[model samples]
Target: MTTDASSSFPFCPERWLSKGIWKEREIPAATTATATKKKKKTETKKTTTTTMTTGRALEAFDEGVAAAAAGDERARRRARRALVRACEEEERRIGREEERIERRRDREEAEEEAAAAAADVAVVRAREIAVANREAAVERRKEVVTEREDAVAVEMAALHQEQMAAGGEEQSRGEEE
Candidate 1:
């Protein structure tokens, strides 16, 4: 059985001219539609972002120009001060955001360290408890051994006394005879 090269290799250029391949194909139309949709969405998003940024910059510049155009020197100075204050406020806001991020990172690291330290402490405590339990077991065993030794010694002493009594009785009987 022979397989057509176009049927076997779908992406090969030779497949485009192959029989029965281009008859029902809508790939070009579909690709164009998809490309147009993607381009439209991206352009819209870009335009919106640009407009917002430009609006903010224009507002800042207008405030600065209005302050510089004040009739009285003191009023102009106040406007200039206000513009400076606005710029400083923006800088401070940016700095605060950066500091907040840094603080969050530091806090996360500290919490992780604390958790590790807590785990270490738990391990140490468990080891200490195990040691304590072992020591108690050893002490109990020693007590049991000492009690057994004392009982044995008492029984031996009693046996020796009984033997001595019997010997004395025998001696007395012989003397009498």
Candidate 2:
């Protein structure tokens, strides 16, 4: 018996398959066509994704920059509004303080006027009292003078009556002698 080098290793099928060891001589036609279509579709999808990714990255970067600029503008507006509010509040406070001072000044003036009026009334009352005291003293002096005049008139009438009676007695004695 003589054996070739390939037939000596029966477990290995690489030489036997090439020589039509199986019943089917080639792979199925349908299977080959389906595999080719699947490979082409996978390659097309990868190429499209790679080409479009750059455009999408640029659009996203532009949007981020715009958003940052808008935020900065809004922050500036907020700071400006805060400063304006602070100035307005300070002006209102000063106005209120000025009004308060004006009211205090007016009150002080009113009090001073009232005090002056009261002093004037007190002076008038004191003058009236002095005048009344002078009138009362004059009345007392008039009453004393009238009483002395009445006493002197009564004494003069009594002396005249006594002198007339003494003259009548002296005439009667001369006629009897």
Best lDDT among the predictions, by candidate number = 1
Between which residue pairs do clashes occur in model 2? none
The sequence of per-residue lDDT tens digits that candidate 2 reaches over residues 69-152 is 566655444433443343344346558879999999999999999999999889999999999989888888888877777777
The local distance difference test score of each candidate is 0.56, 0.51
- The top-ranked prediction according to TM-score is 1
> What lDDT tens digits, residue by residue, belong to model 1 across residues 1-177?
014322332322343233322222121121222234654563322111222222333343344445444444555454445444544554565588799999999999999999999999999999999999999999999999999999999988888888888888999998999
Over 4 Å off in model 2, which ranges? 1-72, 155-177
Clashes, model 2 = 0
